[model samples]
Target: MIPFFRKIRQKLLSRNKVTRYLVYALGEILLVVIGILIALQVNNWNEGRKQEKISDQTLQSLEEEINEARSNLEKIISFNERILELSNRFLAGELTKDSLENDPTQIFYLTTYAFTTLNFAITEQELSTERTILGRQSLNAKLRISLQDYLSMGDLEELLGNFWNNEVLPYFIEKKMMVVYNRFLKQESINKEDIQQIVNEEKFVNLVATTNSMNYQFLNLLKQLDKDLEEALVLIKEEEHD
Candidate 1:
């Protein structure tokens, strides 16, 4: 192609058609510029398509993550709810010592700490790194902020951990409250007398009440996180399809 164009230029120059040569040269330059522009535009289009596919994959991964988190959160919520219910019945004297002794797992339920399921570290890190791929700068920023706010509940989690370890567990051990459950675990016949004795104690009632209060607070936090995740999922889905 280059040799053909050079031949035309040489012919025009040999004929001393300087004016025509200049015109032909200018036309050739314009054509080259247009060709370069077309090539650049096609390359840009291919890159955009590749980026869009990647963005879709990222959003799909995030959606799956949110769903898993929601599932785990629901289980934790149900467990905490059961714990609260048992604690309330026990504190109100509605659950008899016989009932507790029959279901030694009731004791297990009341003492267990509430668990959290708000893990967005992977999601957050991916979003942060693929900010351009996600492309809703303001929405992405808002979701990141919301995720951080939920993660801040770690402080509450730590508080519960310290309370369980430093206060609750030690107190239960001293009172031999866990001994009944341990014996039950070994398939040993639970001493009904021990269960009755623990229930009648003021410290037993106090610890149960304290645990109930803490678990209730933790449950509320999980519920809030659930709502936020739902909202984020909605926005993300919209962005994905948009």
Candidate 2:
């Protein structure tokens, strides 16, 4: 192509058609400029396709992740409910000493019912790598808002972690409370008689109530997150059809 253009330029210049040569030169420059622009636009288009593919894969992974989180949350919710039920039963004088002794390890389990919310591991990684995720044109307003809210829950998860460590854990693992079964420390679990005696305390009954409250809050938080997860999937489907 370059050689053909040069040949035409040589012919024009040799014929002393300087005015026509100048016009030819201007046209040649325009063609070159147009070609460069076309090439650049194609490159940009390819890059955009790559990004959209990445974004789609990210969203799919996120859907799976949120679903997993919701499933886990459901299990946790059930667990918390069971804990709350048992505690309420004990408080209401429905649990006999014989019944308590029947499940002696209930003391260990109930007292140590500490839980942590699942972190958005892959979602966070994707967001960190792609700062423009929320602003992405491929992501609709609804999905973006849900994602933003869900990401912000990291702070809430962290807050819960701190609370569990500071208050909940210490409350349960008090040396006088549970001589927990520890292989590392070679500590033996308390006898059934000891567990029965421990559960007989007013503080133990009150602690059960406190745990019920904490578990309720945890369940509520999970329910809200589950809503976000469902919203996110709905938005994903909407965007796909659009």
Candidate 3:
């Protein structure tokens, strides 16, 4: 191709058709520029197709993660409801202390179980990969922003960790203390004064109330999580349309 263009140029110069030669040269330059532009355009389109495939894969993975999260959340919510039911029965005196002490249901109400059950583990790498793919400036702008906001605000791992440590753990410790004082110590026929002394130590009353409140708050948070997950699914579906 190069030799062919050279031969044409030599013929044009030898003819002394300067005006026609200049026009030919300019036409050749334009063709070259157009070829380059076409090549660039094709390359860009291919790159975009590859990126879209990657984004779709990422979205699929995220959907799987979201499903897992939703399932886990449902389990947690169910468990919390059970705990609340048992606690209410105990509080209402419909369930005797002895019956409560012996009930297998009591085990389900334990904060330790809640901690273990609700502690949904997620790897930072998964989130980072999702964010990187979604962060591309080439992505649909609204979709990119939606993904960013979800990544920033709707972190399952962080929410689970905070709920377990800040809310669940302390609540469990307080409940254990209460069980030891109100049930075990009382069973042992410990002096009322001594039991009172134990209850008075280290903000025991405050802890018991806080523990109860934690269960309530956990339920509330679970509701919020369910809403967030539903919203995320909807957003992803919208992105698919675009």
- Per-candidate TM equals 0.82, 0.72, 0.64
Q: How are the candidates ranked when ordered by TM-score, highest leading? A: 1, 2, 3
Using TM-score as the measure, name the better of candidate 1 and candidate 3. Answer: 1
Q: Report how far off residue 94 is in candidate 3 (Å).
A: 4.5
The whole-model lDDT of each prediction reads 0.78, 0.65, 0.57
Whichever of 1 and 2 has more lDDT, that candidate is 1
How large is the C-alpha RMSD of every model relative to the true structure?
Answer: 3.0, 4.5, 7.3
Off by over 4 Å in 3: 92-95, 98-113, 116-207
Model 2, span 71-155: residue lDDT tens: 8867876776777677667768887677865555665445344364665777667656664255554444444555665555555
lDDT of 2 at 166: 73
lDDT score of residue 133 within candidate 3: 53
How displaced is residue 108 in candidate 2, in Å? 4.5
Candidate 1 residues lying further than 4 Å off, grouped into runs, are 15-20, 96-101, 117-122, 131-133, 137-142, 184-191
Give candidate 3's TM-score: 0.64
In Å, residue 105's CA in model 3 sits off its true spot by 6.3
